[model samples]
Target: MKTAICYYSRHHGNTLRVIEAMAEAGDAELIDVTARSAVRLEDYDRVGFASGIYGFEFHRAVADFARKYLPQGKPVFLVYTYGGAKGAGAKAVAKIAEERGCPVLGEFGCRGFDTFGPFKLAGGIAKGHPDALDLEDARKFYRSLG
Candidate 1:
């Protein structure tokens, strides 16, 4: 299927790394929400939202993009990177997709080196993460989407 992933991966670029690995493993279009305000998804068969966890949610840009542009009943999936936990951001995004009548295919998440907030004072956490193994796992997750 032709897939498009709208994502926001600022700070450490951890989310970007995972998204890149997934795209490399399959035919997918990567959309940086920060670079573009609006996108047309009618040509894509599936849509994905990816972001680094920010305040226990997907980045604002990603959430806003989905709210504004995601098509009704489109197949949707989520991928995220976090320093402390997983699923929170995915759940939030999934809810949005569900409300739009999109069937959520699945979700994938992993640790990304986090230096945000107070963690920066302690030299950060999950250092060196979204590493080789994490990237491989992302590729596997992408393959599973088929």
Candidate 2:
């Protein structure tokens, strides 16, 4: 499959670990959405939108990018990392993709190191997360997709 994963992983880079393992295990393009504003998805047979959850959603830019530009009628999947089960963001973004005619594949998530807002007071949460086991699970998840 010609696939691409567009992601945003700031802070502790916990989310990056998962995708890097996944990318290394599979054949796919990994795009860090935070570093660029525009992306071309035309060549991909499958596309993924990944992010770190913020306030029950993905980074605003990621959500907006999916809502605004994710190609219609394509197969799209989701990946996320969060401090808690707050990625109600996935549902919102999935709905947007579905409305645009993108077929929903599935979703995957794992806890990432979080220090946003109040959590920052404690140094961090889920430190060293998206660790070896998490990365292995992510690799399994990608293999399962086939």
Candidate 3:
């Protein structure tokens, strides 16, 4: 089945690394939310919403994309990269998907380098994270979703 990943990867580009790895294995398209509008869900069989945590939430652009477009009855999933595990970007997106009548197939996350403002002062916690190992795991995870 065809799939698409709609996301925003700012600050560290960590989320994109994971999503790109996944896309390589899955027949999925990647849409950078900053560079495009919400995509037509009918073009794909499934959708994945991915992004980095920002201010304890999903990136504003991703949130807006979800709010603006989420196809009805589509299978959806979420992936996020975060500095710490406490944030709820994945949870928030999952809720949005559910509310939109999309069945959530699965969700995944990886620890990523953090460079959001003060987080960069320390040269990024989890430096070099979302590394090759993480990318491989993400690809495996997405493949399983198929």
Candidate 4:
């Protein structure tokens, strides 16, 4: 399947690592959501949104990118990485897909090193995460779908 993943992987590039493994598994395209121009989602058979969890959600840019350019009626998926796994990032993206009448294939997330706020004081958390095992799981998740 032709897939495109719109992503915003800042800071430690945790989300990028997972997506890269997914891309390597198939002919998936990576569209940076923070790019200068918007991506046209209709170019692919499947679409995905990915980012690191921030403030209990995905980076605002991802939601904005989807709202601005996501086409209607396409199969969508969600991928995210975060220091703390508890967040609404996937839920929000799934809502967007539902609103556009898109069938969600699945959502996946893995632990990522983080030091955004309070955690910074302690150096970081979830260090060495999204490691080999996580990448293997990510690959498995992608293979489970298209």
Candidate 5:
């Protein structure tokens, strides 16, 4: 399937690592949501939103992109990395996709190195995460979408 993953990977690039593995395994296109404002995804067979959880949600930019640019009736999927525990990041985006009549195919979440806010004082949480196994799992998740 021709897929495009719109992503925001900041701080430690934890989400980026998983995204890269999924792209390599699935041969999908990557869209950096932070860099682009207008993206056309009509040509893609499936669309994905990926990001590290920020304040228990997908990064604001990513969610905004999905709200503004995601195509109607398209197949959608989610990928996210979190520090302490999995949050509502996936659900937040899925709701947006659903509003556009898109079908949510699946979602994948994993621990990612985090140093945001108070966690920074303790050096960080989920350090050395989105590791080899996590990347492999992300790849497998993407493959299963087909």
Candidate 6:
């Protein structure tokens, strides 16, 4: 399948690890949301939106992309990485995709090293995360979509 991954990975690039592994496994195209203001979904059969959790939500730019430009009636998936396991960024993305008439194929996420704001005080949790096991899990998740 022709797939495209739209993602935003700022901080320590923990979230980007999963996206990268997924792309490499699937041979999907990768679109960095920071570089591209909006994604044109016409080029791919499936679109995956990936991001790091920010305050229990997907990043503002990613949310904006989903709201303003994600194609209607397409199949989409969500991939999120967070320091803690309690957030709903993946659920939020799935909800947005559904609202846009896109079928949610699946979601894949995991706890990644977090070193932002308050978390910085302790150096970071799960340091060096999005580790080998997480990457393998992500690869499997992407493969399962087929």
142: Cα error in model 2, Å: 0.9
Q: Tell me, what's the RMSD of every candidate?
A: 1.1, 1.5, 1.4, 1.1, 1.1, 1.4
Q: Candidate 5: which stretches are off by over 4 Å?
A: none
Off by over 4 Å in 1: none
lDDT of each: 0.90, 0.83, 0.84, 0.89, 0.90, 0.84
Measured with C-alpha atoms, the lDDT of residue 16 in candidate 5 is: 89
Clashes found in each candidate (C-alpha, N, C closer than 3 A): 0, 1, 0, 0, 0, 0
User: Would you give me the overall lDDT of model 6?
Assistant: 0.84
User: In candidate 2, what are the lDDT values of residues 13-42, reduced to their tens digit?
Assistant: 777778888888898898887677777787
TM accuracy, model 2: 0.91
Candidate 2 Cα outliers beyond 4 Å, as residue runs: none
Q: Model 4, 76-145: lDDT tens per residue?
A: 9999998975567678778888999999999999999998888899999999988999999999999999
lDDT of 5 by residue, 17-118 (tens): 999999989789999998986889998999999999988889888988988888889999999999986657777888898889999999899999999888
lDDT of predicted model 5:
0.90
**Alpha-carbon deviation at 72 in model 1, angstroms:** 0.8
TM-score for candidate 6, please give it. Answer: 0.92
Per-residue CA lDDT of model 1 for 48-124, tens digit only, reads: 89999988889888888888998899999999999986546777778888899999998899999999889999999
Residue 123's C-alpha lDDT in candidate 2? 82
Per-candidate TM-score against the hidden true structure: 0.95, 0.91, 0.92, 0.95, 0.95, 0.92
Q: Scored by Cα lDDT, where does model 4 land?
A: 0.89
Model 4, residue 12: displacement in angstroms?
0.3
